[model samples]
Target: MPQIVCPACGAINRIPPGKPAETARCGKCREPLFQGRPADLDGAGLARHITRDSIPLVVDFWADWCGPCKMMAPEFVKAAQALEPLVRFAKLDTEAAPEAAAAHGIRSIPTMMVFRNGREVARQSGAMPAGQIVQWLRDAVLALGS
Candidate 1:
């Protein structure tokens, strides 16, 4: 079983393979931590979670108003569903996490950042299909030789 540290509320959640997202809960906040998709994160929390955790991270910076962003949302969710134990996926709404977006120098919506061992390894901007997203994630992991 692998663990997913919640970026939103800082709950270290142990998520076993095949575990239904409906049952996943945060130990600290006792909130519905896993929503069968990437957990949205803010600036500080996003930094903390990415640095503290050992697993690779994929972050999507998006906003509600962006049309391309909305198109990418489902693909992100699907990627999250397929890439358990290998990668951790998260989302940050630029509207809500403006500081984070600025800190990361996210000039556009649907920006994807891939981090490994607390360092950013790759970044891409624009909307992509599910297969392409998965390939990009695998490429990032392969680059790390992990």
Candidate 2:
């Protein structure tokens, strides 16, 4: 069995083998495990997702005051819409979670990091369109051989 961290409540849910995780629900919160959009994360939520999620995670580090971050928000959501279930998309506000941002060494707004098995494997800093994000994430993940 594999464990997935619920996007709704940060609860760890074991996924049975040969089951479709997209249709799975969190036992603790009874919420659908895979929502078709990026989930917003605070410091604790970011930590939980990074440490506990079984699937690959793409986190966008952004701040409210950042113009590029605002511009890329919809594109990020579009990428999430196309990549959910197999990959998890999340956003961490640097303004609100400064410590988390610093810990991750986020030097720029709208930076993205891809994590697998509790470690960062890929990182890119920029604001790109949905198509580019999806392709970049897909290539990075495929290269990981997961």
Candidate 3:
């Protein structure tokens, strides 16, 4: 079984392998696990997601005031749409969740980090197009096996 942390109610749900994640709902909250959209998380929420989830997590640390962050928002959404079920996508507002940003040592806005098993496996800074974001995540996942 794969353990997934629910973004809505912060409950941990166990899902059987070979079952499509798109249709899997949280056992406690009844919310879809893979919504094909990035979940907006605060500091504590971010911590719980990263620490508890067994799947790969990609977090975009952004700030509202950043022009690049705003520009990349839609691209991130597109990427999330393409990458869900394989990767869990999340976003954190650096301005609102400074503690999470600082904990991750994010000095720049629009920083993306890939985490697996509560540890960072890859990181990329700056804004990118949706295709590039997807490719980057694919490469990161591939590298994890090497």
Candidate 4:
């Protein structure tokens, strides 16, 4: 089992790999937490959480009005479902979390940033299908050796 800090309600959830979708519940809000997108994070939390978490984080920086962002949402969700045990996925709405967007220097919607040990390893901007997203994760994880 692994502990996943829920971005939805800021609850630290202990989730087993076998039942991530079932076991994932926010400790605070009791909300069903694991949604297949980047977690919206603020300045300090984003810096600390990404750096401290053991697993790789795939963050999707997006906005509600962006067409490409909407187009990639489903693909992101699918990718999160397939890669649950191995990767921690989150979605950040730039409009909602402005400070986080600014700290990350996000200039566009649909920008995906892969982080390990709080350090950015890879980033890409644009819409990618589930296959490509999975492939990118595979390569990124392999490159990180974890």
Candidate 5:
């Protein structure tokens, strides 16, 4: 069983094999497991998603004042929409959670990191188009054999 931490209530959930995750609801809060968009994360939320999600987690570390970050926002949403239920998408506002950014050694905005089993496997910086983002993650996840 794959364990997924609920983006809504932060409850760890396990979906039984053969269950369709797109229509699955959280066992605790009953919120849909995959919302087809990035879940906004603060420090604790980032930690939860990084450490608890069984699926590959793609986190965009960005801020309000960053132009590239803003440009990548919709592209990220498109990637999320296309990849959900297979990969979990999230966003961490570096402005709101400076501690988290510092902890991760984020020296620049628009840094994207992919995590699997609580460990970071790949990272990229700067903005990219939706197609590139989706392809990057697909290749990364494929390389990880996840």
Candidate 6:
């Protein structure tokens, strides 16, 4: 079973293989696990998702005041729509979570990080189109196998 951490209530849910996780709900919160959209997470929520979830976690570190971040928002959403069930997408507002940003050593807005098993596996700075983001994630996942 794959363990998925619920973004809403931080509960861990076990999912059987070959099951469609897109329709799966959190056992504790009863919220849909995969909403086909990026989940907005605070610092603690980010930590929990990264560490607890069995699926790879892709986090977008951004700030509301950043023009590039705003421009990349829709692209990120599109990427999430294409990548869900294979990966989990999340967004953290750097302005709201300065400590988390600092902890991640994020000096630029619109930074993306891929985490598996609570550790960072890949990172990219700057905004990218949806296709590029999807490609980047696919490449990263491939690299993990190597």
Against the true structure, what is each candidate's TM-score?
0.80, 0.96, 0.95, 0.77, 0.97, 0.95
Q: Give the runs in model 1 whose Cα sits over 4 Å from its true position.
A: 1-4, 12-35
lDDT of each: 0.80, 0.91, 0.90, 0.77, 0.92, 0.91
Model 2: per-residue Cα lDDT over 31-90, one tens digit each: 999888899999899889989888899999999999999999999999999988879999
lDDT of 6 by residue, 24-89 (tens): 999998999988899999999999998888889999999989999999999999999998978999
lDDT of 4 by residue, 1-146 (tens): 55566666565667566774545677688876666555666655566558656678888988899999999999998998888646778788888888898888898888999888768889999999998999999987856665
Candidate 1 per-residue lDDT over residues 1-42, each given as its tens digit: 555676557866776778774566777787765555787778
Please report, as a residue range, the 10-residue window in candidate 3 with the lowest summed lDDT: 137-146
Poorest 10 consecutive residues by lDDT, candidate 6: 137-146
lDDT of 5 by residue, 17-124 (tens): 999999999999999999999998889998998888989999999999999999999999999999998899999999999999999889998999998999888899
The pairs that clash in candidate 3 are none
Best by lDDT: 5
Q: What lDDT does candidate 4 reach at residue 99?
A: 85
Checking candidate 5 for backbone clashes, the offending pairs are none
How well does candidate 1 score on lDDT at residue 43?
83
Expressed as tens digits, the lDDT of each residue in 69-111 for candidate 3 is 9999999999999978778899999999898899999998889
Colliding pairs, model 2: none
Error of 6 at 138 (Å): 0.3
The list of candidate 2 runs beyond 4 A from truth reads: none
Clashes of each: 0, 0, 0, 7, 0, 0
